[model samples]
Target: MNGNDQVSRCGYVAIVGRPNVGKSTLLNRILGQKISITSKKPQTTRHQVLGIHTEGATQAIYVDTPGIHLAQGDRNKAINRYMNDAATSALRDVDLVVFIVDRTKWTEEDELVFQRIEHLKVPVILALNKVDWLDDKAELLPFIQKLAARRDFAEVIPISAIQGDQVSVLEQAVAQRLPESIHYFPDDQVTDRSQRFLAAELVREKIMRSLGNELPYQTTVEIEQFKYQGKTLHIHALILVEREGQKKIIIGEKGERIRQIGRDARVDMQDAFESKVMLNLWVKVKRGWSDDDRALKSLGFDDLG
Candidate 1:
């Protein structure tokens, strides 16, 4: 059949919820790849990452957004505001929204998410993630019943994104609702971001995983150079921090910690890109840059005001 005669499904799908609810994990599960970074820290995702999945006749472009949360306390920083706005913006012009939540765990931020999407005309599918960890499975039904009364959801699916449970069902549900249109991307393509962007994120992911409390949040990764020659790639990255003390924490005694971070990140980069990698890392202090809007824009967070 020709393009006009064949019925093809394609559209954007926004996955949103409060922090630490496994929004990024759900996206990685659906795509069967780690396109977005995940961490135990709330607000690990500072930008809206796009992951596209195509099956037989359906294409679902998933937008993995920063968790929507109440902006207060230390979370009231400029970067936090930028993350909130980016997540909110992903809701616009989408075919469907996958509202992910933790199983039987509802917080004030969940209520905030409800309020954000209450007036939207789009269809929402409530995904209760991490059901595998639920101690009492019998409570699932009652919880769904109570949540159902709060909003008119298209479907309420209980899933475990980390364990790869019921994610296919969620994928099928999203695919069925998408409109008939040509695919916006090639079928082989999985994400809208380039390798350089993903590389920087991978480095930052290592920073988040390695550092002690609060140190990672004060840091951002920037790729000074990335070049490929023959079968190997060379990368030079800088970790930007707000204070000299934070820089010292990252570098560690005798530069052991930063070296370990670079080693781990390079291994991950090799696996993700399927090539040998040479990663060089440096830590620098940019004093109070996270709060400075102009500085944030220079660091590639120009999407928000």
Candidate 2:
């Protein structure tokens, strides 16, 4: 067959792991956009982020999921259920799944996720990440040996998602397993999330940084409005909190917390749009919002509903 007539390689890849395993970091590195928020806090990603990577004849669609865990209360139950459901939904008729595990250690939590993947009759690649924090290769041998023991994986590749080490090799490994097909996304497309969604996510990320871990799982961002006129991107957003005390912390003294968040979010918006950004932010109180059906719907958290 002629080179031009040959079919391209494309596939769906899901990066599944427990919370804070650097799944979002890997997605951003591959797709080259900040679609998912990264934090030291577990369960940082509460939704499925679709990241598209395209080059030449290879197009890889990567799905990032929140850490799957056992559900407890209404909020944890809701979040964990969404994560597991989203992972299962993304796995439908897909080409492969990348199981990301933190290099520091493996616990019962990690084993539980791997066990779930065992039932799925598809290619699974085990990606052991965060090698940069280690000065000794000897530190990673045990984990490597554990992976080798599992004959279930198609391949076992270790990488530092933050440093972009061996990421391309992982991509190439993914591409090698993909069945030949047409490109699923345009060459220039980076992610499935709209500019509006990304803006809200950026704002939420800022809030995650502004406040401590107390604010992350308790807070969410909604894009109130987004418009463009002349040379500026006009945007308004609301940061939702579950309690009044949380709102106070987010607004800070003399509104300094919100000010810092606004400034940082503005810079990211400008970078995304390549133009000046006019951003308006507000801190709103929504009592037990995570458990409120209306609140969840309003904030785009109703994935199943």
Q: What local distance difference test score does each model get? A: 0.89, 0.81
lDDT of 2 by residue, 1-305 (tens): 12666558888888888778899999989877777877777777878888988877778888887777656674464445666677556667778999988885888778777777877888899888998777786878776776668747888788999999999889988988887887878878888878998898888888887777556477888888899898889999988887888888899899998999999999988987788999999988887777665667677876631
After superposition on all C-alphas, the RMSD of every candidate to the true structure, in Å, is: 1.7, 2.1
Model 2 stretches with alpha carbons more than 4 Å out:
1-6, 73-77
Instruction: Please list the residue runs of candidate 1 whose C-alpha ends up more than 4 Å from where it truly belongs after superposition.
Output: 1-6
TM-scores of the candidates in the order shown: 0.96, 0.93
TM-score of 2: 0.93
- Kindly list the per-residue Cα lDDT of model 1 for residues 7-99, writing each as its tens digit: 788999999999999999989888888899988888889998999999877899999999998889877888888899999999999999999
Candidate 1 lDDT: 0.89
